[model samples]
Target: MAAMQNITVRGVALCDKKRAGNVHVELYEKDVLDPHDLLNDTHTNLQGEFKLYGEQDELGTIEPFIRLTHNCKAKPGCMRVGDYVVPTDKLGGVYDMTYVPLDIVVSGEGEQCI
Candidate 1:
């Protein structure tokens, strides 16, 4: 069996067409059934950027995913938070996940938010 190699994933989060800072971002092994299986957790910076690092087999690869959560539109007695998922292909080697947008929307009483 080959030795384990280090892998790094990076990306950005955006909500409502703007940078989403302080959002909870988690990285998990693909196909994981438990939240406890999370590999790493990091929050976006003021510029909505984040990075995660892990290890995988040199001969093989590990599937990774990014989950993002934000509460940019929550209100009293109402829930307008946002949840997003980004499943990534096997990272056989070090690579950049690049910038990803998680556009969130808020609507109520049949009225659209502008």
Candidate 2:
């Protein structure tokens, strides 16, 4: 059997059509103060959907869950081809994660973690 350190995290990402560019996600414990994480580059994508998995450390401390949901909100006039992903105007993103126990079922309020 795998060691108790075998903890996994999984999730899906969705964004509006206006939101373009790639997305990134990282995991962390509930309380942590840091801009970077030990588990670097947990999530990355060139498509619309995003998923990630990682292990936990002692004290059950997982890396911070980071995400890039929005990008390239700027583009003067119009850029032809797939070159629409240009950062010039404005960009915003949301970051969150749901912790699930592998040993038991979890009851929640809503789907998508928010």
Among the numbered candidates, top lDDT falls to 1
Off by over 4 Å in 2: 1-7, 17-21, 30-36, 40-44, 60-64, 72-114
Q: What lDDT score belongs to each candidate, Candidate 1 first?
A: 0.59, 0.32
Q: What lDDT score goes with residue 81 in model 2?
A: 18
The clash tally of candidate 1 reads 0
Give a tens-digit lDDT track for model 1, residues 1-114.
776645466777766668778977776655445443467788999998888876645344556655565655545443233333333444544455565555445222121232
Model 1 C-alpha RMSD vs. true structure (Å) is 6.7
TM-score versus the correct structure, for each prediction: 0.60, 0.37
- Per residue, candidate 2 scores C-alpha lDDT tens digits across 1-114 of 322232233434333332222544444323355444334344334443444443444454333333332222223442211101112121122222332211221232112212
C-alpha lDDT of residue 61 in model 1: 50
Worst 10 residues of 2 by lDDT: 82-91
